[model samples]
Target: MKMSQTQAPFARLLDAPVTLGDERGRIRILYEQGNVVLKRSSSVQGVFRGLHRQAAPSLQEKIIRVLSGRIYDFVTDPDDSDGVIWYREITPETDWVHINARYAHGFYALTDVEFEYFCDGRYDEAAEESYNVADTLRDALNLGAIQLSAKDSAGIPMSRPVRRAGDN
Candidate 1:
């Protein structure tokens, strides 16, 4: 996973999920300016919530190794609802495989619902599992749904599907 330009330096810092500790893995590259640490806690929060603070541990590393100026395509699902999720792939060596093997495998295989943020506000930012978690990951990050170009990375990965309470 190396970038295209080695000597020119990246246009901007980009972050990628890296295997580290147990619960709090690692996010390398610190994309956002000034944020140095990422934190995580199992609390209910809505997706796309406006100006909400996230709890995931902020991962930081001095710009060193450059991999895939482009985020690899190993985390996408080619099937399911609208194919809307964006997931990161994990394997046995990676910490996430044990965090929840079922979900991790599904995400890697595109058989599970991936997490996604929609509406750009509290209405659908980080909502919990309404559909299959495996399926959700795939839907929320699909190229057509989020429409993120192949050249960039998304702010968040699709860990599960989202929905409102009054749905039929």
Candidate 2:
């Protein structure tokens, strides 16, 4: 829900995810000379060849939720095998946090078959159930209701990425 623009080094940005308590979230941070993008979805979670009782959040929701407070319009990845849904959030913020809640929750809850079935457009009931679960998990994680660190009983409060060694 917080947004900002920053100029920093990649390694310094890398340490941000670790410090922010995403050790288990498997987040990947990408950077350019002018912007930082924190990615929290794994590549493995996106593919679908079948469906199960559990489904991950659609790609559209992931972008909308993480980059909150922006107006998002629906878009589609025609190149994707499943035609992965995407959203274009209109905003000027340069730094972003991208969490694939569906993937994160589905990685634990859904089976490959379920994923495929959802992709095939056969199981709306199951997909909705899984989506609710994914949303709940993402909300908790985003709001710090789920603590990623044992040492920090209160959860990781949002803060600017702390500077580390090698940082400019």
Candidate 3:
């Protein structure tokens, strides 16, 4: 069933469908040492769903803006592509690491700032909702704080920052 704009973000399902698909991608940021890898199984749902809790008009734009500056490279690039530059989904070497960011808490990649959201092969559905979530993320990162109306804050929680990458 199609969800309404007013509806909350995606679900925090146990079995989420996530993958890089056939197309190539990239990990646009360099947090700690070198290349960082974030598994999706959880990040997608958490990030995207976390956004739906609010009532913002420019949610996706916010997410893109914040991520744009931080993301340095893509998996489809040339130099790293030869070694390990593709952003495609691979089998996780281990269980996800729960990065305790101030805001929302979820699994994060040790070296990278990316993660996967297992959505039961419903990426098309998730994609449609990503705009709002991405926008919310953008606001969270750029504005350093998201101020939503009381009504918009209905199902939302009072978390500071969602996930922190390689922050010990």
Candidate 4:
């Protein structure tokens, strides 16, 4: 069955049929504008029959923005295709204490290797999402804060400047 735009964003699952059932009742799948044949096993049918529509929340962009500020910026080295440079604000405070420095002793080599991995698309479909996420991170860093419309436990919206350790 095709889900309406008003429904939760489940573009991939739109093709799936809508099922309706209860704890102690037989599942009845309501047919929509399709001629699909149900040949799956009862176990598989039971799973979807007991499924409930829910709204999935997405906060990846906000999380990435906040995390980006806590680390250095990385870029592929122009001179060497297999080299990358991960450098943060060169201040007296907060140096050499890199986030992922524990695993890799040399930050330069790690950054370069990671960039090569990115170029090969080892991660998700990063050709586009990577740039968009990078842009969001840059904006968050430049603005000094991740702008979000979330509220606290007391129902108060938070809008404070992000500060690192030992920041004046």
Candidate 5:
């Protein structure tokens, strides 16, 4: 389903059909796209990962799916005047989320979780940029005391300029 146009950083949920199997696990086709890279992440409860994105020339459009457990997923456009942060509660049963390349993406694991995403572009270390979730979305999230990786802990504050490799 599409979100309102008034929302900054366009994103939407995509429906997937699941085929049930007798005495076996189910099969669900999340997405099918050629030349996409797949990434998987496993996070324990109370862990927060990202508000991360790559800059232009290496930007990636992503399709995210929760393989197990639950999370509060978020996406935002750093350039938007309103600084709007769009979020949703996602689970294995939820529709997959498609986020445009311009938005930064992140999630807070509400329970032990395993999730995967398909990216249209390869990862570029020099082009990576991230916002400090604690600094940017602490008040908005209100989920006390989340853990962050060292790289994520050192993320740039949203109030400051986001610098890419080629920026002067």
Candidate 6:
């Protein structure tokens, strides 16, 4: 499978496997790794989720696949000097995204959507951190009037210092 690099140095776009079988049915393997957590989420159009990551010891590498509908996905490394935010429009049409643990991930639902992700680490609520999507990305994209979860709405601005694991 060919992997396409996104603008973010730590993320890539992978082509999903083609399905096999006839009109009777079809089957495709989305992933084949063990010791990872699988998660599913559904969102309505106009919803914006994340710019989130698990810090330090709890860092997670995620592979996201859109099961239905469409989304504008983004990834960025907060520590990068260049401050590049890579984005792509994703659909169910055989595109999967791989985000490294060091990058923050987020997406805007362009339509009612369902997606599944495989994470290499267990979630640690206390280690979770997020950047305010609007403050960081709104000017870069044409996202308008997006709805955010209470936690997401309260995310720290990109200009603020992110707390690392040992900060006192």
> Whose lDDT is greatest here?
6
Off by over 4 Å in 5: 1-35, 159-168
Off by over 4 Å in 4: 1-4, 7-64, 67-69, 78-86, 89-168
* 89-127 per-residue lDDT for model 2 (tens digits): 333242332333243222221111111101212223434
lDDT accuracy of residue 144 in candidate 6: 71
TM agreement with the true structure for every prediction? 0.18, 0.19, 0.20, 0.17, 0.71, 0.71
Query: Which segments of candidate 2 are over 4 A away from where they belong?
Result: 1-23, 42-147, 156-168
Instruction: Give a tens-digit lDDT track for model 4, residues 1-168.
Output: 455564556543434544443331222233333323221111111111100011112101100011111323232222233433333332223333322211111111111111100011111222111111222233445534221111111221212222233332
Provide C-alpha RMSD values for all models, in order. 16.5, 19.2, 18.3, 21.5, 13.4, 13.3
Q: Deviation in angstroms for 112 in model 5?
A: 0.5
Clashing residue pairs in candidate 4 are: 84-112
TM-score (C-alpha) between model 2 and the true structure = 0.19
Give the range of the ten consecutive residues with the poorest summed lDDT in model 1.
42-51
| Clash tally, candidates in order | 50, 12, 28, 1, 0, 0
Q: Is candidate 4 or candidate 5 better by TM-score?
A: 5
For model 3, state the Cα shift of residue 79 in Å. 44
Q: RMSD in Å for candidate 4, one decimal?
A: 21.5
Candidates' C-alpha lDDT: 0.25, 0.26, 0.25, 0.23, 0.73, 0.73
